[model samples]
Target: MATKMVGFVWAFLIIIGIIYALLSGNISAINDSILTNANKALELFLNILPIIVLWTGILKIAEGSGLLDKFSSLLKPGLSKLFPSVPKDNKALGYISSNIVANMLGLGSAATPAGLKAMQELQTINHKKDEASAAMITFLVLNTAGVTIIPTTILALRIAYNSSSPSIIIIPAILATASSSIAGLTLDYYIRKRNK
Candidate 1:
């Protein structure tokens, strides 16, 4: 439903823009913009494609080499505390750890499969199928406020755009994401405690 609404909004805005451009006798400008932006978008996508592919390959290698499992093991204790309802041996925890690790490295696209798998695994244990479980809500909060230590996509974009200091965003992104994660977890904790 939200996706449909967003699609409708984009369509409405595009229609409005076309009508305004026609009335203002700036249809030529609109045409030029469409072509220019399309080219630029394609250029940007091509530039970022290699970086995404490289990171995704590395992620796969980590998984195959058991590095991801080792990382997940390190995260399990803290994850168990956060999601007490989930059984310690549940596969959801493993997927959640992989998703979090991928996100931390700024590979959101790479993390998506693990995130989806985690949600599915979480759902299997949900007592109330119609309503989201508290663990699910907490996971949502954590994913939304994901603490990215490295903003790989943004760095790639900066590099593509010829930024002289692409890595300069590293510290600020870490600080912002860490703060948001802390705030979100704190709020979630209090809300759950109050509900109990």
Candidate 2:
């Protein structure tokens, strides 16, 4: 549904742009913009690809070295409290921990596989397959309001765009994400309590 909405929005914007360009007798500008922006998009993708690959490799190394397991264990106590429905020894918790850690470092592309695995594991324990379980909803909220510490992707984009001080956004990103995480968790807690 969200994908459809995004597609509709892009289509609407493109139609509006073309109509405005025609009305303004600047249709050629639209052609130039399409070509230039496509090149810029490709350049941006190339610039970010290395960073994503490096981080993904690092995450894989951490997992292979048992570092990720150690980190997941450390997070388990709190996670257990957050997701009481999930068994303490469940693989879902481990995947959830890994996903959160990856998001915290701003490695969203690397986090996707873990997140998907977490959801799959959660589904196995879900009694009502048609509806999202409480744990699933909570996880969704947490993931959406992820507390990012590094903001690596944004920093990479800033560097690619020639920003004078790419790291300047670090503090603000941390504070904002932390606030969002806190608010989301608080709201989820209340909703859960009310449901019970």
Candidate 3:
């Protein structure tokens, strides 16, 4: 897997190099762009750290206060119906619910650990020897196409770039993410049905 990933990266770099060579007749443009972009990337990353930390810290407080569990319970009935394979009492369901809630609020830092735990719990429940179970696949799809609200990371980037209306992206981000989530789940359902 590591080798395959490395190979893919090399292939991607080769493609980019070809494009750069064809356009500029030299690699100097690419070198300069890489140096400039690396600095910008680092600055952007630093700018977002405070936002991520604040949100994740809030999530920890919510979890400790048991508010997350209460919210999870409120959401559980519908989620249970959607993910029939996951038992109501299962830890995976709790983790998944927390992860989803965090993602919906655009708290990626907060969602990471919960999502990892959910995946671990899901892997534990897999009865099959060779492949992922339907529930696991569905969860992966849901996580990948998460329903975002604030889009905090993008907002942070916008702010770093000195955008005036960073928060104005909220509505569009919510709509776009919600639509992607619906599409992902719908596709997962069809695939699961076809496989079954």
Candidate 4:
């Protein structure tokens, strides 16, 4: 459904752009951009590929060393409060912890796999697989409002663009994400209580 919506949006944008270009007599520019967009996308992918590989490798190492498990254990107490529906010794908790940690470090691309795995684990215990469970909603809220300590992608982009203070937004990012997370969790709790 989301894929279909996105496709519609892209199609709309392209049609609108072409119409505007026709009206403005910039058809050549539009054609040029259409031809070059793929190359630009490839270039961007090549630039970000090394960072993705490096971070994925580091996450793999952490997994091999049992570091992720150790961290998950440490988070169990607090995370249990947030995810009471999940089993005490569930595999879902580990993936959730890993996802949170990766997001906190601002490794968005690296967090994707763990987040997906977490959802998969979450679904196993869901009575209605077609609908989201309470724990799943809570996890989605938390992940969507993730607290980023590093803002790594933003910093990397800034550095690539030759910013004088590439890392200056770190503090602001942390504060904003923390605030968002707290607000999101509060609302989730309120909704859950109302439902009960």
Error of 1 at 171 (Å): 1.2
Best by TM-score: 1
- What is candidate 1's CA lDDT for residue 156? 87
- After superposing candidate 4, which stretches have Cα over 4 Å from the reference? 57-61
**What is the per-residue lDDT of model 4 for residues 1-196, given as tens digits with 9 covering 90 to 100?**
9899999999999999999999999999999999999998887776656665676677778768988668657876799889988998899988888888878766677678999999999999999989999999999998999987766556656766789998888888788888999999999999998988
Indicate the residue-level lDDT of 65 in model 2.
95
Candidates 3 and 4 compared: the better one by lDDT is 4
**Pairs that clash in candidate 2:** none
- The superposed Cα distance between candidate 3 and the true structure at residue 194, in angstroms, equals 3.2
lDDT of 1 at 120: 98
Question: Predicted candidate 2: what Cα RMSD to the true structure?
Answer: 2.2
Model 3, 1-196: lDDT tens per residue? Answer: 8799999999999788869786888877777876798798788789998887777787788879988778867776777777888887888988888888888777676788999898888878789857888988888888889887767678888888899888997888778888988999998889878987
TM-score (all chains, Cα) for each model: 0.88, 0.87, 0.82, 0.83
Predictions ranked by TM-score, top down?
Answer: 1, 2, 4, 3
Candidate 1, run of 10 with poorest lDDT: 147-156
By summed lDDT, the worst window of 10 consecutive residues in model 2 runs over 147-156
Encode model 1's per-residue lDDT on 77-140: one tens digit a residue: 9999999889999999989988898887777876889999999999999998999889998998
- Candidates sorted on lDDT, descending: 1, 2, 4, 3
Q: How close is candidate 3 to the true structure, as a TM-score?
A: 0.82
- Ten-residue stretch with the least lDDT total in model 4: 150-159
lDDT (CA) per prediction: 0.88, 0.87, 0.82, 0.84
